[model samples]
Target: MTPEGKALSNIVILGFGFMLMFTAFQTCGNIEQTVIKSLNNFTASGYTSMSIIYGVFSASNLVAPSVVAVVGPQLSMFFSGLLYSAYIAMFIQPRVWSFYTASVLVGFGAAVLWTAQGNVLAINSTDTTIGRNSGIFWALLQFSLFFGNLYIYLAWQGHDHISEKDRQTVFISLTVISLIGCFLFFLIRKPDPSEPTPSETSEAPLHTESTDSASVSGPPRRSLCTQALDAFVKACKLSVTKEMMLLCLPIMYTGLELTFYSGVYGTCIGAMTRFGHNAKGLIGISGILIGVGEILGGGVFGILNNNRLGRNPVVLLGLLIHYLAFYLIFLNIAPDAPQAPEEGTDLQAYMTPNVGVALFCSFLLGLGDSCFNTQLLSIIGFLYKEDSAPAFAVFKFIQSIMAAIAFSYSNVLQLPWQLLLLVVTGFMGTLSFFMAEWGVVAKRRDSDYDSI
Candidate 1:
C-alpha cells in the first residue's frame, strides 16, 4: 500500500479498535448496574452479589496488562470479546452459579479490553498528541456507556407493568449488544507502524543517552526469568520517580472516590428497596446522572486541557466540586424525625432520605469525576512518552485492586452508614489535589533534565 493509504488504514483501525474498547468498557458498566436490578427482580441479595462481581473484576484488572503483553493486544481483545459474549449468554439463565461465573468472565474480559486498548493507543500516538487522543478516546468510551445505559433503561421501560418474560427479553437484548461488538472487532487492524512493538520498547531508557547507557551496561542479561524480573524491577524504579509517584496518588484517590460512590449508590438503592421504596426509579435516575456526568466531565476536561488552563487548577476545582457533592449526600442521609402516626411502619419516610441523597450525590459525583479523570490523563501524558501504556495500565490495575477491596468490605460489613464512605472519599480527593499539584512540578523538573 502507499504511505498515505497505510496511514489512513492505521487511523481507521485505531478508531475501530477504540470503538471496540469503548463498547466493552461501557458494556461492563451496564452489566454491573443491570445485575443489581436483575437480582432485585429475582428477590436475591443485590449488594452482596454486585459487590462480589465488582471485587473479582477489579482484581482481574491487576493482571490483565501482563496478560496482554504476553499474548499480543489483538488476540487479547478478541478473546475478551468472546468471553464477554459467553458471560452475557450465561446471564440469561439467572442461576446463582450462572451469575457468579458470568461475573468472573465479565471481569476478566473487561480487564483484557482495558489493557489491550491502552496498549493500542500508546503504540499509535506521539507524545504531543497522546493527551488529545487519550481525551477523545476516553470521552468516546464514556459516550458508549451513556448510550448503553440508555438502551437498557429503554429496554426495561414500564417494568412495573411488564411480565417476567418481558424482563427476560430486556436482558437478552442488552446481551446482544456485546455480540454485535464482537463482530465489530474483526474490522480493527493491528497496531500502527509508528508505534513500537511491546518487546522492542518495553522500558524507557534511564536517560537521554540510551545508546551509551546500553553500550556501557552491555547486552541485556539472558533468560526469560531474568528479563521478566529485570522488567518488573525497572517498572518499580520508574514508578517511584517523584513525578510518577505523585501522579499515582491522585489516580489512586480517583479510584477510591469513584469506587466508594459506586458502592454507596448501590447500597442506598438496596436500603431504599428494603424499605419498600421506588427502587427501580432511583436506580434509573442514578444511571442517568452517571451517564450525564461522564459525558459532561469528559467534554469539559477535553476543552480545558487543550486550552491554556493548566491541568492542576482544573483538577483542584473538580475535587472541590466533588467534595461539596459528598457533603450534600451526607445531609440527605441524616435521619428526619418520624412524621405519620404509623411512622415506624412507614416505608416512604425511610426511603425518602436514601433516594433524595442518592440523586444529588450522583449528579455532583458524575460531574466532578469527569473533570478529575480528564486532568489525570493529561498529567500522565505530560510526564511520560507515548509508551505510557504499560504505566497507565499498571496504574489502572492498582486502582482496581483498591476498588475491589473497598467493594468487598462494603459487601461484608453491609454498612448502614453508607454516607460515611463519602467522607473518606472527600478526604482522599483533597489529598489527590495536592499530589497532582506536586506531580506537575516534578514533571517539569524531569522535562528539564530531558532537555539537557
Candidate 2:
C-alpha cells in the first residue's frame, strides 16, 4: 500500500481500538456515581473516585511524554490499555480499596494513553489533513457512547435498579470487550520519521530531543530516569510559552464541561423519580443522543473543513449552543436533582421535568463538546506538530486538573450553581481561544513578510 494509504489505515485502527475500550468504560463511567450510591448509599464515593482519577491524571501528564518517548507510542498505548482493562474489571466487586486503587492506576494510564494518542495522530497527519483526521478519530471513538449505552438500556430494561448478578455480568462482558480493543494496539505500525511535517520548512522541529534517536534499527540505550527528566523539562518550557498560556483557559474549560456532560448531567437524569420507576434508564437514552450529537459535530467541524472556515468561529458556535443547553438545564431540572432521588410530589424544578427537553439538552451538550475538542486538536496539531507529545501532555494536564476540580465539587454544588460556572467559563474560554488564534495568524503573517 502507498504511504498515504498506510497512514489512513493506522488512523482507522487507532480510532476503532479507542471506540471499543471507551464504549465499555464510558458507559460504566456515566453511571458510576449512581451505581456506587446504590451499593453503599454514600453520595461522595463515586465523585471521590472520579476526582482521584483526574487528579492523578493531572499529575501523570508531566511524565507521559517521557514514557511515550522511551516506549514509543504503540507500546505506550498497549500498556495503558492494560491499565484501563484492570480499572474496568474492578467494577465486578466494587470494593473501596480495590476501586480507589484501580482509579489511581487508570489515572496514570489515561495520561499516557492520551499523550501517545496525540503523538500517533500528529505523525500520521499533514498541515491540511490534521483537522479531517482528528474528526474521523473523534467520531469513531464516540461510537462507544452509543453502543455501550444501548447495551445498558437493553440489559437494564424494565428494572429500576441494577441487580448484583446483572451488574457482575455487565462488567464482565465490558472487560472482555476492552481487552479485545487493547490487542489492536499491537497491529499499529509506527510512523516513519521521513514523513513530511509542517514544521520541516518553516520552523525548527519540536520533536522531543531525547526521542530523536528512535529509528527503524531501534532506539539507543539511555538512562530511563535521565530521559524522563529531560522530557519533563521540555514540557514545562512549552507550557510557559505565550501561545500555550493563551490556550490554557479553553483547554481547562473542556475538562470542566466534559465532567458536567458525561457524569453530572447523566446522574441528574438517573435521580429523577417524577418520570416514574423507569426514569433511571433515561441515562442510557441520553447517552445515545449525546453520541449522535458528537458524531454530527465531528463530521461538520473535523471532517468537512475547508479554508473558508476556521477554528474560532466553531468555538464561538459551541459557546452559544452551550448557553442554550445550560438555560434549558437550569429551568427544566431542579437544583437538587443530582443530590438524591426525587419523587413526583417532592420535585421542585422551575418547570416540570420533561424527558424530551432533558434529552435535547443532552444532545446540545455533546455537540458543543465536539466543537471544542476537534478544534483544539486541529489547533494543537497545526501549531506544535514537532513537539506533539509534550504539547499534548500540557493540554491534558490542564484539562485533567479542571476535571478533577469539577468532580470534587459535583456532590457539593447544586445544578444551578454548576450551570452558572459552566456558562461563565465557556464565555471566558471562547474569548481566550480567539486571542490565541489571532496571535498565531499574526505570527504567521510576520514570518511570511520576513521571507520576502
> Candidate 1: where are CA atoms >4 Å away?
1-62, 155-163, 189-239, 260-279, 333-360, 412-416, 442-452
C-alpha TM-score for every candidate = 0.75, 0.93
| Candidate 2 TM-score to native | 0.93
Candidate 2 lDDT, 1-452, residue by residue in tens = 66667778878999999999998889888878767766754333777888999999999999998888677677788889999899889889878888889999999999999998888888878877888889999998888899888887777665677778878888898899899999887776645446555533221122332234354444345565665677788899999988899999999899999999889898898787776676667888889989988988988889645455578889999999999999999988878877674232346578888889999999999999999999899889888887888899999999999999999999789989999999888899999999998987788789989999
Q: How well is each residue in 83-154 modelled by candidate 1, as lDDT tens digits? A: 766655655566666767767776677667766666555544454455565566556555554555555456
lDDT leader = 2
Q: Number of the top candidate by TM-score?
A: 2
- Residue range with the least summed lDDT across 10 consecutive positions in model 1: 336-345
Q: What is the C-alpha lDDT of each candidate?
A: 0.55, 0.83
Q: Any runs in candidate 2 off by more than 4 Å, and if so which?
A: 40-44, 192-195, 198-226, 341-345, 448-452
